[model samples]
Target: TKEHLISVEQGKQYMPTDTTQNSLLNLDLLENSEFSSITRRQFISKWYSFSYWIIFAIIIISYLVYFILSKRSVNPIEIRRRKSTKIAIKRLKNARFCLKNRDFDQFFEEIEKSLWGYFADKFKINSSELSKETIDLYFDKRNIKTETKNNFVSLLNICEFARYSPSKDRNLQMERTLEEAKEIIIEVESDIKKK
Candidate 1:
């Protein structure tokens, strides 16, 4: 506040006074001989300037692309989720071999594994948490079709039942169950794509 305050001193002193209206000028604008001179400067070539701008534009575009891609980087979970069906199908191929070789136990085991593995990957469910209710939770959350859900459950049940249950027509059952499982996977995959 003290610094901001202004101090003023009052004083008046006079000794002489003179007033003059007419004064002679020392220099005149029109008489100057160097006033009409022109200035010249060096200029770069058109191609050189053009190339500079083009390179700058490319650098800016590339940086923007890098930034955008980095910002939208892929999620590992999403990658696994998208590839779940492919993995399941690959597992089914192994099961198909078992079926062809008449290895019934391995065939059933593979079937069960593929089903559980597919659900685990697709729903992001842990192996320890694999159960009908857990599968149903994700199915209901994702609103999977009732038909697809039923097909999956039925095939799973048959695979589990095949482990201990002796049947006269296991060959037919294997063929039918494998086909149903494939259909169920394809149906769910198509549903995933639609959404």
Candidate 2:
């Protein structure tokens, strides 16, 4: 009886099955030439669309990486501070050389420039707007002593006067002025640290 039952099942296995009923081996789409062509075109179009989107995504990701890297390398405040300090020191050294060579006009001019450049860099003050009153107001707000503010302003005024007047006594005042200017910068730097 079992042998007969197995033979009947084997016979059913040899019978033809409906093409559309089997999802894995369905051939209806291929049998229709127009439908197969349309499906191939749709697949190609979808491939092109997916490729375009992938390219766009890659571009956006690269830009995001570039933006992050650029931002990571920059620190505006530290850059400004370092550059200003270097320039100020170089100018001061040049002024000292001028003093040693008895170049009064150049020495005064360098000192004035160093002070103005320092203020402009440190406070974002415009060069054209750098005046004694502006310096006084800025230093006063920072809690710098009245005497220190007066001394800085007075030094600037002296530089301006000596630049134009060509006084004979400028040589005598050069060393003292340089020292006072150095002291002013040191005091201001220390005050900034305290803040």
Candidate 3:
């Protein structure tokens, strides 16, 4: 009641420079006191934006983990095929060296070994248990021409016979056998590529 009874002279002198009052006014403006509340649409938009970011982060993290695991994964069949091919190539090189030295016995042995090694690699078969008949049957089953399979078989048989028989012209036999083996390897390589 006394505050309401202030005279015009007293009202004119009511200039209180309180720092606490100024600070409170600044706080009120910072808090947007003029706005009573956020609208429903504004609230939903903010929530959706936050959730979108969270989902995107989860998707990115999941893909990164999947990529890391895929990079480390190895196929067993591919590993075996690579190992066998490497061994086959090495054996072929050894056979060529034996041929160059005119060591008919070693040449025949290496050729036979290399041929079987190539077959084992091409078909992913056990080299130790392989036979000419089995190899021919495999090639036949795969729709390989009879002529090609017979040539490969005959070459293998020649190498075996040359290795055991006491032949006078062993060097000539080695040359023929080496050529035949080379042809078989080339054919097999082409066949494998086709498959």
Best by TM-score: 1
- Local accuracy of candidate 3 as per-residue lDDT tens digits, 76-191: 55556667656766776787788788787888888888778777766777767699878877897776767778888888888888878948977777777777777776776666
Cα lDDT tens digits, model 2, 91-137, are 89999999999998899999999888877777667778988788888
TM-score of each: 0.65, 0.58, 0.57
- Superposition error at 141 for model 1 (Å): 1.1
lDDT by residue (1-195, candidate 1, tens digit) is 356878886558743433332221223332353532221111335557888999999999999999977755567776677788889999899989998998888898998999999999998877899998887778877888878887788888889899889478988888887888898889988876677
Model 3 residue runs over 4 Å out of place are 1-77, 82-86
Clashing pairs in 1: none
The 10-residue segment of model 2 with minimum total lDDT is 1-10
Residue range with the least summed lDDT across 10 consecutive positions in model 3: 32-41
Error of 3 at 177 (Å): 1.6
- After TM-score superposition, the amount by which residue 179's alpha carbon in candidate 2 deviates from its true location, in angstroms, is 1.1
Q: Which one wins by TM-score: 2 or 3? A: 2
**Superposed Cα deviation of residue 149, candidate 2 (Å):** 1.0
